[model samples]
Target: MKIQLQTLYNEYLNIKWKRGLSPVHTEPFEYGLYEDDSADLFLSGHSEATFTNWMSELRPEDPYYGSKPNGMPVLADIFNQLDVYDELVLYYLLFTLNTTMSIHTHNSYSEMNDWMKNYSFFQLAQLNGLSSLNDEQKGELRDFFFFFYLYTHPVNEETLYACSFREQDLIHTKTNIKLEHYFSAFHDHYSENRDKYGEQFLIAPHEIQACEQLTLELLRIIEGKSPKLSMPSEEGLEAVVDLINNVEQMLQMYAKNRTLVFDVMRNFLADPRTGLYRNHCFTMLLQNYASYILYFNFDEIHALVNDFRDTPAWCGIIINKIFTDAIFIHKIMRKNAIDIREYPNVIEFFDEQAREFCL
Candidate 1:
């Protein structure tokens, strides 16, 4: 199993990513990950630009080569293409919070930094397919993290320097946790940083604690230990569950009444447990919801436009293209000397949202 896992990791390292799609140490905006056309380009599966093509290339031996029915691969199904350990590690590297930052700061660096820093393992487990892994696979994941932390060169400080700060902290903390203390230097470095920054910059304190608890829980489950005393670690797990539930509720409500989405947004943003503000993954999902809702629910324009003001400023900014559509419509109506009142929905929505351009 170890040999096979090593071979898979080697193959993964050898696999090349599409330009601009590769793992980047720089901010998402600086690298164009959040460009207006990114989602469209990704959904369209153009050449090597989309994840679908990337995964298809990964599993060339398969008959279908990882193509899904929609031609766009879902996050969960992406894991099914790889060995359990491979998925676990790669997912962590790709999505987990990394402390590395560009020395050159972008204007919205703090905003994007919050997103990057708070994209923790708990969220990844829910967003990725780890939550759906079978018991055997779960055991393998647990054992992989355990043995890999101890026996592997991950503990070497020199090697860790190349890793993101979050991964390095996890290794050091795990070593001390196992009472091995093999990486005291790393632990001391983590301590100094935590003191300076209030916690490890790479991984939040709660998340680090959660990861430890999760591993212990997995060990107990593998050993047939059924129920145990309640621990604070479960809070992190519950946070992920709450996030998934809130997203589902928001999406369902959005389909019925676009206006109701504002209420959902208020509740989600106000509730600290959802962590939507800090989490890049969830914030992007909300922005996506707003994007489509704006175009498809123009009939509910008055309510939608009015309620959107109550959402975070960033929400409106992220979907600024919707405002562009309003501008185009208003211009056309004015050019024909059309009575804007005849189009009450558009006029009212435009007046409320883009009042400066209203004729």
Candidate 2:
């Protein structure tokens, strides 16, 4: 069944490519179904009105009602004649089309609001054939959805509030309900199944260990300890860099209030690094501590002691070192403030220090 679905999907993509309608080559800004004539090929003889009508049915209260079908009727009928997996594939394709194209249209705002209000994550999952998936396949799908939500959803309250109020009263209420409730439900579902699904659902064990080692290396650099270093994968390095950037941004934003800075720091540090390098947490700790020294006033440094006490023993020691030695703090901050640019420079710096140590 999976093989058949894959074949159909490949065929669909091949057809699109042949017709010069492949999404891969097109700019995302050029992806609207209503705006792009090439997107008509995706409808497979069904009219744009037909697709809209189908979407409208997903939320019966949709403001733009149409006479079209709910699922892609042509493809649905073809796949329905085969196995349920085929139908699932068709639905998945439809869902992708809706997300990638139709949702970009001006008219789609109300339609999307209505649909999100009417459907739970699980219901949408089921509609897309997720219920029939094996545990391994389900885990992969979960990762896709989790990252999609993480990257696409508004990260801050202000943006979320703006999205909540973007349209008509009916849509405003529905959109808020969907965005607010979806993540809670997604977290609950993944949390319950995480153990049974195993570590493959996130980062592999070796990546986690590498991340941990990388964390220690970053901490040593921040502390002026000149520890021996082994290079981590590019992905691990990037994750560490991203953590540093996030911490620096946070510190810059909340530099005025020491308490609020620590609060924000703690919240970011406490988040699980699911699908990230194991040392991700450690990198965050080092970055936050570094940012603290860079941004916080010496007089207000005493407030950080309480916060450090709540962290790991190692983190506590690092925090204490920054608080106690003014000269050491200045030296560390000066060298560490050089922004990490190319990864090879970091590797070379460590390599140079190793030869001096041996001598």
Candidate 3:
């Protein structure tokens, strides 16, 4: 992917060079009061003239100011030297900064506005002639920018520490098996069948019964109705038990207090510094997963999921992972139990799954 991205970037640069439109250096100017506030405000109105003015305003005394050349020509030249992944990281960092600044500025002044309708990073990129990216590259870029935004924003870090039990819900929904049972069965099935089957397996009656018995024992341990399993540590029984307990706790919390779920989620999702843009955008995405436990608008859940999955952000990465995992687990279950036929190897299975499930 990095190699492909580099090739695409080179092609883009070649197009620019052939047109004799390489970025040029200009004299610096004073940017006035815009420097005191969000840089997005200045950048939104950016022209070669504005960029020059903004660069001129940089002061030696400013703690954040570095000695790197601030002109576009110099910056473009620097970009040419970076590896594709490094270039993406640098571009996404800038994107997050601008997005954060823009969201903060919008929230301060517009008490009731739909910023999503007004703002878009994709549009901004296209306007700047940055349209060389393929869908996969765009997804990676969104994920990178989102994580950058999430970690940098000022919120109680603890709010972000919740166990993501959505994966369990996904497994249950897709496979029609409880998560505990699924994991136990999957572990046993993988151990016994992996080498023999080479990605194709048939379920014997004994294997099914053994899996059921193991699942029951796991449930007993998780429920505190029995002592810990005596299995070898390599089997990861302890880790499975821990996961079950954490997910159980999360479910209990959701069942006991719906408002608490929203409140904690709001702390993570509602912050303007994270660039969710609109209140509804946050509410919509939260509703997709939260609505399974809480009573909220259900009509838009699929649309919301699609929206989040399409957007290039941390939320999208998360949604994609959750659904992708569910699909993978479902495939595994089908292969081991029901299919009873030779299937595509694991790599092919994943490639097919990615095409079906991922953005």
* Ranking according to TM-score, highest score first: 1, 2, 3
Structure candidate 3, residue pairs in collision: 142-312
Worst 10 residues of 3 by lDDT: 121-130
Model 3, 100-202: lDDT tens per residue? 2132233522422222212121112221111333445434333332222234342234322211223213122222334443344433544555465442333
Clashes of each: 0, 3, 1
- In order of appearance, the predictions have TM-scores of 0.25, 0.21, 0.20
Name the runs in model 1 displaced over 4 angstroms. Answer: 1-107, 117-123, 128-245, 266-285, 288-359
Worst 10 residues of 2 by lDDT: 163-172
Which digits, one per residue and each the tens of the lDDT, describe model 1 over residues 1-359?
Answer: 01121222122222211212243231111222333322211212122232112122222132223543333222233223433333233323322112111122334434333332222112222222333344554443333323322222123332222222132123222212211121222223333444454421444333333333323333232222323211111233333334333444444565677556555445444555633223333344443343233323334445654676545363454334344322323323444465545645444444344555454
- What lDDT does the true structure give each of the candidates? 0.32, 0.32, 0.30
Regions of candidate 2 where Cα sits further than 4 Å from its true position = 1-4, 15-37, 40-45, 49-53, 57-145, 149-359
Q: List per-candidate RMSD values in Å.
A: 20.3, 22.3, 27.4
Which regions of candidate 3 fall more than 4 Å away from where they truly are?
A: 1-85, 103-253, 257-359
- Could you tell me the lDDT of residue 194 within candidate 2? 46
